[model samples]
Target chain A: MHSIILFAHGARDPEWARPLQRLREAVLARRPEADVRLAFLEFMTPSLPEAIDAAAAVGATDVAVVPVFLAQGGHVRRDVPAMLETACARHPALEIRLQPVLGEAQSVLDAMAEVVLAG
Target chain B: MHSIILFAHGARDPEWARPLQRLREAVLARRPEADVRLAFLEFMTPSLPEAIDAAAAVGATDVAVVPVFLAQGGHVRRDVPAMLETACARHPALEIRLQPVLGEAQSVLDAMAEVVLAG
Candidate 1:
C-alpha cells in the first residue's frame, strides 16, 4: 500500500493542525483506500521521521510527502529535507517521493487568486 | 477603490516570494482595475504596515489584508493582527479588513484536498 503524508510546519497552537487534518480527511473521504497522514516539522507530534518510519513498519513500499507550505521557505526547503534524509537512512527500502511546494502548484495559485479577486 | 494585500511569511530566498507575487498578478489579471500587492512578515520587503500605509496614502478608502498562511499559527493569529492594529491607528479612516487564514477557507481547503487526492 502507498502512504501519502501531508507535511506541514506545525505551530505552538494545537489548533493549528486543524486545516491539515481536514485536508487529510478530505483526501481520505475521496479515496477510502488511500493511507493519508499528517507529519509536522516542529511544535507538534509525529515528526516526518516518525510518520515515514511508521509507514515503513506497515510495509508501505511507496510514500509521497506533499508540503502544504505556502512557499519555498526554510522549513520546506531546508528543515523538511533534512528530516527526510534521516527517515531515508532508517528505511532504505522505502520508495519515498517529495512533491513540490503547494504554493507553486498551478491549481493552488489559481485558487488563491480566485479568492483574492472575489473580495 | 479597494486594495487587497496578499500577505505572507517571507523567506531568505528571494524566489520564495514568487508564488505570492504570482498570486498578486493573478488577482490583477482577473480584475484589472483592482490594486493587489504582496507584503511579507519578515526577511522580505514591503512589510504589512508599509503596504497598508501606501494604500491609505494613495487615497484607498477600503483595504483588505489576506493572510496567505496555511493555518492559524501565531504569525496569523497574533503577528498579523498586531501589525493591522498599528496600521489602523496610523490610518484611522482607512477601512482595513483582515480575512480568515487561507487554509480555513473552504475553496482553498478543497483545492488542497483535490491535490492530495490526485496523488
Candidate 2:
C-alpha cells in the first residue's frame, strides 16, 4: 500500500491543524483506501518520523511526503530533507519520496490568486 | 485606488520569496492596474508596516492584506491583527482590511489535494 503524508509547520493552537486536516480529507476523498496522515514540524504531535513509522506499521511500502507549506524556506529546504534522510535510513524497505512544497505548485498559486481577487 | 498586499512569512534565503513573488504576479495578471505588493513577517525586506506605508504614499486609499498562511495560528490570529491595528493607527486615511489566510480558502485546499492525488 502507498501512504501520503501531509507535512505541515505546526502551531501551538490546536485549531491550526484545521487546514491540514481538510487537506487530508480532500486527499482521502479521491482515494478512500489511501493511507494519508498529517505530521508537524514543531509545537504539535506526530513528528515526520513518527508519522512515517505509523505508515510503515500498516504495511505501506511507498511513502510520499508533501510539505503543505507555501514556499521552500529553511523548513522545507534544510529541515525536511534532513528528517527524510533519517527516515529513509530507518526504513530501508520503504520507498520514500518528497514532493514539491504546495506553494511551489502552479495550481496552488492560481488558487491563492483567485482568493485574493475574489475579495 | 486599492492595493493588495500578499503578506507572507519570509525566510533568510532570498529565493524563499519566489512563491510569494509568483503570488504577486498572479494577482497582477488578473488586475493589471492592481497595486499589489509582497511583504514579509520577518527575515526579509518590506515588512507589513513598510508595505502599508508605501501603499499609502502611492495614494492608495484601500489596502487589503492577504496572509499566505495555511491556517490561523498565533501568527495569523494574534500577531497579524496586532500589526494591522498598528498599521491602521499609523495610516488613519488608509482603509486596511485583513482577509482569510490562503490555506483557509476552499480553492487552495482543493488544489493541494489535487496535487497529492496527481502523484
Candidate 3:
C-alpha cells in the first residue's frame, strides 16, 4: 500500500492544526481509500519519523511526504532532509518521496491569488 | 486607489520569499491595474508597518492585508492584529482591512489537495 504524509510546521496553538486537518480531509474526500496522515516538525505530535514508522507498520511499501509549508526555508531545506535521512535508515524497505513545499506549486499560488483578488 | 499586501512570515534564507514574490506577480497578472505588495513579519525587508506606510503614501485610500500563513496561530491571531492595530493608528484614514489566512480558504485547500494527490 502507498501512504501520503502531509508534513507541517506545528505551532503551540492547538487550533493551528485545523486547516491541515481540513486539507487531509479534502484529500481523503477525493480519494477515500488513500492513506493520508499528518505529521509535524515541532510543537505537535507525530514527528516525521513517527509518521513514517506508522506507515511502515501498516505495510506501506511507498510513502510520499508533502511539506505543507509556505516555502522551502531552513526547516524544509535542511531540517527535513536530515530527518528523512534518519527515517530512510530506520525503514530501509520503505520508499519515501519528498515533494516540494505546497506554496511553491503554481496551482496553489494561482488559487491564493484568486482568493486575494476576490477579497 | 486601493492596495493589497501579501503578508508572510519571512525567513533568513532569501529564497524563502520567492514563492511570495510569485504570488504577488500572480495577483498583478490578473489585475494589471491593481496595486499589490509584499510584507514580512521578520527577517526580510518591508515590514507590515512599512508596507502600510508605503501604501498610505501612494494615496491608497484603503489597503487589504492578506496573511499567507497556513493557519491562524499566535502569529496570525495575536501578532497580526497587534501589528495591524499600530498600522491603523499610523494611518487612520487608510481603511486597512485584514483578510483571513490563505490556507484556511476552501479553494486553496482544494488546490493543495489536488497537488498532493498528483504528487
Q: Which candidate comes out best when scored by lDDT?
A: 3
- Rank ordering of all candidates by lDDT, starting from the highest: 3, 2, 1
Q: Lowest summed-lDDT stretch of 10 residues in model 2 chain B?
A: B70-79
Q: Kindly list the per-residue Cα lDDT of model 1 for residues B2-108, writing each as its tens digit.
A: 89998988989998998888888888888899878789999998999999988987889999999888888888888888898899999999999998777677788
Q: Judged by TM-score, which candidate is best?
A: 3
Decide which is better by DockQ, 1 or 3: 3
Query: Candidate 2 residues A1-119, lDDT tens each?
Result: 99999999998899999989999998998899999999999999899999999999999999999998888888988999999999999999999999988888988999989999998
lDDT of 3 by residue, A12-109 (tens): 99999999999999999999988899999999989999999999999999999999999999999999999999999999999999998999999999
Predicted candidate 1, C-alpha RMSD: 1.4
RMSD of each: 1.4, 1.0, 0.7
Q: Kindly list the per-residue Cα lDDT of model 3 for residues B1-119, writing each as its tens digit.
A: 98999999999999999999999999999999878999999999899999999999989999999999999999889888999999899888889999999999999999999999999
Which clashing pairs does model 1 show? Answer: none
In candidate 2, which residue ranges exceed 4 Å CA deviation?
none
Which 10 successive residues of model 1 chain A have the least lDDT summed? A110-119
Better of 2 and 3 by TM-score: 3
Write one digit per residue (lDDT tens) for candidate 2, span B9-104. 888899999988988888899999999999989999899999999999999999999998889888878889999999999999899999988898
What is the fnat score of candidate 2?
Answer: 0.92
For model 1, what is the alpha-carbon lDDT of residue B80? 83
